[model samples]
Target: MGRPILGLRSTLKSLTRRDIKSYMSRRYSAESVFITATGNVNHTKLVRALSDSIGKIKRSGKAQVIKAPVATRSVKLVKRDLEQVHLCMGVPVPSMTDRKRFELYLINTMLGSGMSSKLFQEVREKRGLAYSVYSYLNLCKDAGSLVVYAGTSKESFGEVLTVVLNEFEKLATELTIEQLNHTKDQLKGGIVLALETTDARMMKIAKDEIYFGKSMPIKSLIKEIDRVKLEDVRKSIENYLSPDNITLAAIGGGMKKRDLPSVLK
Candidate 1:
């Protein structure tokens, strides 16, 4: 109840119909809801039907006070008997609305999206340290982070983490013109490919509206991705990927927090 906002299994099991209804009554409101659609749809008819159904619900008038999530740098080591150790290293980054997010996407693609990525090439192709290694961006409305995940033997866990951390440190200055262009192309291709389906298009529409309060055309987004210069990427890395913003977490046997090298910065 103190920190677990979603509550645990025991707390969930204690919920009754009345409790759920009460919570919903306080949280669900017309002002907080959004409806979006894609494909052949009659907008007027859809709105009419929705108004007849959803309009009946009253507004709760509970002013939503959203706060940005705080990112604290620390290492969390969870002990467990397993064949391999799993780790997730993360650093704070700007929210989705930030202009730098596009560059961050390019950075993520360059760092871990494919076999050609730096992490895959160094960790799996060259050193044989991990079977799975990748980095991704997790951005919400007001806060976000870039996270890397890898799994390896306990003996190799420290080495893998060190390699990943070194990559993070090198990213600000080590990016090349060729790498930047290639990563830009990769990111653009992925974005275009993901919008081929109706559902994907629908989700994109919803997100664009939610984040920007307007519909952003794919061409505009592609153009923005294209406009991201090398300097922009380096600036974003300098701003967000510093040592003080990084957090490392691991789950495995034998490895403890003390065993981790103080290599972050």
Candidate 2:
């Protein structure tokens, strides 16, 4: 629940059989589990099968409550003689359930979801500063963040960071109505295309239930995306994209923590 959502290998190796048993006993129960199914299936037979199997699991007294995670701002640099420097920089954003959720998605898309996005267009295509650059949102139950990642030569890392930060700062005001509409189309198209498969549909349904308590219809989702105005994206940027809230992690050769870009300082 900290910086690393996945436990470290060292800690995983230290876990004993008793630790696993204790964790399962404390966290695994009918109350804490959710079962979701999609595609062509008989509901009655499904219910019967579930009752005979998963329903038999003993019910715990109550669900284990997870403490919400907090985002921290820090810079870390790891030295290694790798071929390229890799960096992940991000800032805290609203939770998945926030009203500006769609706007956040649009912001992410406008920044770097595709080759046409600002970061890819500026950092890789036009400037040729980096080979790979993209941005994505990592949202959870009560907290979230927008992260930008890039891989480049060690000598180009500073220019790449500067270009990424410049694009980030421009999001508050420079985002145009045309760009917003194009981003909406991109996101909507992707969402519809993803629903073409059973596995994708199943995952979407599960995620919707987990995050919003009910599965939202595709039309409704598209409508939400369409409803996001340029002002909404600007407002989201103002609320969440503060430089002071940024965190940076870079792994490469010869870079020190003190060598972080001035924008991050």
Best model number under TM-score: 2
Give the whole-model CA lDDT for all candidates, comma-separated. 0.85, 0.85
Residues 157-186, model 2: lDDT tens digits: 888887887887897778889888988999
Model 1, position 177: C-alpha lDDT score: 85
Q: Model 1 Cα displacement at 43 (Å)?
A: 1.3
The C-alpha RMSD in Å for every predicted model, in order, reads 2.5, 1.8
How does model 1 fare in lDDT?
Answer: 0.85
TM-score of 2: 0.93
Q: Residue 96 deviation, candidate 2, in Å? A: 1.2
lDDT of 2: 0.85
What tens-digit string does per-residue lDDT give for candidate 1 at 1-265?
A: 0147888899899999999888788778777677889899999999999999998888888746668757788878899999889999888888999888898898888888888988999999999999999989888778888989999998887788788878777888788889899888888899999999999999988898878888999999999999999998998878777767778888989886555768642
Model 2 segments more than 4 A misplaced = 3-14, 257-259
Steric clash count of candidate 2: 0
